[model samples]
Target: MIFNSDTSSDQVQSEFKGRVSLLESDVKQKNCSIIINDLKEWDSGTYQLRVITLPRAGSSVWGKRSCPLRGYCNTLVEGEISAEAGLCVVIPCSFTVPDRIQISHIVWFKCESTKWRCDHGDMIFNSDTSSDQVQSEFKGRVSLLESDVNQKNCSIIINDLKESDSGEYQLRVIGLQMEDALTFSQKATVAVKGLSQRPTVMIPTLTEGQQTTLTCTAPGLCSGSEPTFTWRWRRRGESDTDLTGNITAVKTENVASFAKRSSSTLSFSPSAEHHGTNITCTVLFQGNVSTEETATLNVTYVKEVRITQNASVSEGETLNLTCKVDSFPPSLITWTKVSDHSSRNGTGTTLQNNTFSDSAQLREERGTATLSLFNVTAGDAGQYVCTVTHMNSTWKENVNVTVIYMRDPVITGNLRVKEGAVLNLTCRDNSFPPSHVAWTQVFDQSSRNGAGTTLQKNTFTTGDYLENLRFLVVALLLLMIISVIVVNLRYWRKSVQQGPTNTKSPSGFSNEPESLQDYDDVSNATARAPTSPNLLDDHTSEGEVEMNFPQVRFTATPRRQTTNRDSSSSHQDES
Candidate 1:
């Protein structure tokens, strides 16, 4: 029997003897195969085939003896790897060996260097001299590819490959004996890169009379070069166009070559035309490209303006006229005061003093000007034209000034007076322009025909003495009537209050009997007195006394007083 090992140690040993037995001579044949009991990897050294004759056809009997094999032994198979960061990496290793060799155990190790060796099948990792026993960072991360170790496919899968796991890896195999242990190592370098890209914006919209700003940011995994920024406006139902306004883009560096980066800001003033428009920003890189989202812009406005004034005004009174126009730029106002009679092209008068006088010409003011009139008069009253010009158009206001005049005055109430009383009369008249008043009295026919009465016309004057005299005469007559009535009443009352004997004689009376007789005869001797007078005297006798004939030699008789008393007594008795 013959055995041979290629690309390995050159030795021939027998496993049945339990010891190494050296061959006496070198084997010198090619294409040789060797077989031995209990074959181990250490016995896998090179061997040669030799032929020896034992005197039976004794002339160097050689029956196709094989020479020592001179070929390389390949235990390690070519491997393929595929990996992603934060995920698993498969190092696929499969091997085909000579049928004499059996793969007892398969193992995986992080390949630090070519000089270092570690344990293959054990749970612990043994380094050169001192056994490390375990790799702390790579302990749980290391896993076998297949569950069947007999297959000799020593592939490995590493889960959760961290940044530190970005090194080489190797595979090792162990036979049934320690001497049969063989390492078949293949290095696989792992690279951990971050995620692909980040999120972005979408379509933009805007309204009329509004401002808008749009922005798009680049994806997460970009680095080095500044990401190209572009803003494009895609109108609704139309193609996109490049924005011309201000644009800005920025990029920052981080740990890895491809790191977090962003591109942003595209701003513009948009109109309703930009509604439903799409704005986009695109970023480009060496291996990949990304686009920031699009967005729609919405816009709104504040407010606007409308028109102003009082339409009517009175003449001879100041007029305040105004014109208002509605606009964002403040519409211009032009005021024109036009007369019905005038033919002026345009009223161009300026109110340097802000006042329009009666004598001043009517004019127009431009650009939000006010038309004001000061001390307006009757002639100044007319149709005033206020023309407000704004946005290349004119708005007109026609104001009519009405001249007002004071109304005439009226006097009211009746004149009162008594009969036969001299009266002073008042004449009053009311007029817009005050009027002159006069008074005159008309006499009756009887007074006119009087002999010495001359007809005269007098111009009655107001607030004059003659005017006052008429009133005074009426007042004096009323006073005189009242005085006369009062005096008569008082005299009658006094007469009644006195007793009959105490009553005094009225004026024009005489106490003498002769004067009384004379008066009586002159009035009427036969008539009795209207009033009786009481006289107190007791000297006369009661009897009648006889008178003698005309005193012719007749002497006056003196009678005794006793006899007169007796006679008076007799008369009294008889009476």
Candidate 2:
């Protein structure tokens, strides 16, 4: 060691003794440095300074650091740099000068690359000159790392690099003295090419009739230039179209010295038409370089159920119905008859009354269901439902069925009545939506009056009536018969009380009384109505005779016929 703490070598190198000395200020600051004066061109080379720090009282090992210094002006830089179009890049660089040299400013120039060196080109950035001196295309796009410049860092960041920007770059350092200005011999080669990076897109689950937003982030994280974004949509089997009206786009920026990012958000409502379509997000940088990302849109959607069939059907006619629904991912369609008690079978058909056979068929491709009843009846009149199940939701539609039917009309009450008697008749029929009843006369017997002439005549009568004279004649006859029978019955009873009567007449008949004989003669001449056996035996009380008088009259026809036949036989015997 030539020197150590307060000690000097007795014999020192003649040229280095006076020129080299320790820097006390650097030592007080916990740094190791030395001062060398009169640096010349021959001394331009790399010099390494190393310090071995003795361990504290408790340790025995020593720590050391190697710091390198260069004489004159020089730069440390990479020979080649990689960059992408429409993005940013950083060229890391540093410089050194003689110990006493002070830096005034820095300048950067982009030049065309030649085999041996760089050709004269445009100035991209300058610290000591006005911004006007820089190229128009590169203005405000090239910036120096300001805080690092004082530490001899010549690093620069280029925003929105283009293919034309690929070239050799030179850095010049200016000092106070005219002889101190220097240009670095080593150059940085920027290989800017077409942008191959794609934008990052984030999308959420989309649903029809729902509003959502999509986010697109550009490639670079440089703060120098802001990027623009665009949104487009391409329907399945169709060309791309710009997404406009009803869509909102917002651009956001995040900038800092070390980190910079740009992004855009797109918001809109999605519908069934947007399902299975492609949506693209494109990012554009300052140099007209663009990148894009595409994603297929999948939307969940459904439509209302519809029943397109007439509900009114005539009895004994075929009742056919169809139901349909539109939806995405298809849908389950079902047909059912709505009744007080209704159920569905596993085959997707509803059964209201198992008594009637119903045919149900489903065509999944067309999303339609059909229900057919071969012969409709009153029991088939009810509400029918079309049910649709899509995704996790369900919907239904209903129709009321009407069966048209009617029965034959009927007439009730007396068909014939005595003259001047009021009669009542009722006509009725069973039918759906009740049948209309009317009585129109096709022929009038009273108006013809046994003549061929047509006569319009009106006869007032309460109801159906028989002729008065004919009724009276029949009544008189019935009275005469009843009187005779009463008299004969009295005589018979008298005879019975008087014991046996041997009285006989020339006619070979038992002689009762004159009234009895006359009753027999009258009965023989006119047909006598017969009395029911039960009536004669019903002599338990005399009041019964009167009670059965009407019955006897109505029942007298058979007896009258028998008497007429006896009279006819006697006549034949006499002939």
Candidate 3:
């Protein structure tokens, strides 16, 4: 170290050798300033410099006093600090003034990194001074941690931080004299980042139509400004909607010595519409800094099981039915058909078909299930049941499925019968809802009416054939003629055998009979055979002619009766 004193006996410490120096020529003008090169944080305390003068003649005067070190009025502060928006940060700062220098006030100034000085407009806080010169935004937000600056605690607390508040802060101390005032060259840097701390949200188990409360707590404890809370609901496929009007919101703040607790609680009744929707709790702080937490709302609910479908399906067509249930968590749907036969368990199982190996096909979605019966037939017709199982509850619904069908009709009776016989016939058809069977007489082309002539009844009958009365009379005459012819033929043949003679009988006999008998026999043989008749009569004549011909008589009888009687008589005779 180079000494500024004129005496060559001056000494320097080993640590300060070649690093500390004072100009001797400048000291001649009463300038004893010393320069320290490559100074470090450890070199920041008090330092003294000693100067010795020539002793007065005879009487010696000694001068020993504390030497004030120039350019040593230092301000201790952090180099950098990081803070989040909507939170608080403490910038620790402390400064010292030269001994015997009365401090007037202290001022904090914010400046950009490139600027070396801050104007009066950059002053954020001033101690023991009017606030007219301090920035309006930081007027109440900036406060000293230690109100007594005599304690050397210049640390300040900035609440409700903002992104624009990031910069370099310088501490300036104003003393009573101009030489006592100083501004620390070492400044503290602050980095205010965007709000990243989300609000804490508490949600409870919610049920449909049940009132519930949700709590939201804002982050940080600055105690600068009261944060505002907002509640919003976002439904599926829709925008967010404010729930302030529909819900009750309560805000509470508890301030302690160093921390401030701020929270909000929202109360509302939940419904099915709130299920699966997102609800957000946002906390807004000073400078429009905001943070939010979102949670999905789950409302437990259950609706009745509904089965919709066309119960009546034509045969050989497909039958489709759907069962649905609305609940918080989707319910499980099961399809079943009521068994026509007695089931061992009473509860029916899945539908089964003899023709289809895979009977009813089941398809499931979120809240609905479909049962499809392909190629439906009469066997597929029954009561179909749909069951839904939700949380711990089970619901059921059923429908009667009908398969429309009809079978070929059949007539169960004899097809042929005699004219006078009693005829009976019945028509039968197998079908759903039963078919109506009627009898109709299908007329031939020869009939005046075409096609079927509905008899309007089921049975028909015919009585005696009186239309054949004239024919019966004609038949009787022919039978009588036949009997007379037979008598004449026999008499003629007897006469021929006994030889021809002309004689008189006792009963008015005549001798001219041979020619007449021959003529009569020929005429009788020439007569046509009796026509087929419904009836015939028998009669006979008696006398000498009756004796010669052995009188024969003929009676009329119904053709059908006569045939029957003959057959019966022949059987009787044979027996």
Which candidate, 2 or 3, would have the higher lDDT against the true structure? 3
> Candidate 3, residues 122-178: lDDT per residue as tens digits?
899989656589988888888887777766667788898988899998778777788
Clashes of 1: 23
Q: What is the lDDT of residue 415 in candidate 3?
A: 84
TM-score of each: 0.22, 0.47, 0.53
TM-score of 3: 0.53
lDDT of 1 by residue, 1-575 (tens): 23333325345333334232222111221112222333457656555556443453312232211112222122221222333344334454555445566667655566554535534432322222243555676665555545566665455555544455655555455566676655543344455454233335432444344445454555432223455666667767878787655455563535232233354666566654454456666655433444345565544321222224443444456656654443322444544445654525655432433454453433333234455665555555556555544445556666565544344445444467688776655445533234666454446663667633433464344656577899789878866665454344334323333323234446322222221222222212221111213211233233211212222111111223455345444544553
- TM-score of candidate 2 against the unseen true structure: 0.47
Off by over 4 Å in 1: 1-85, 100-102, 113-132, 192-575
Q: Which stretches of candidate 2 lie over 4 Å from their true place?
A: 1-82, 94-103, 115-122, 129-133, 172-185, 198-203, 208-210, 224-249, 276-297, 308-323, 329-340, 343-361, 366-385, 399-575
- Model 2 clash count equals 3
What's the CA error at residue 268 for candidate 2, in Å?
Answer: 3.5
Error of 2 at 394 (Å): 2.2
Error of 1 at 134 (Å): 3.3
**Candidate 3 RMSD to the correct structure:** 26.6
Cα misplacement distance, residue 407 of candidate 1 (Å): 38
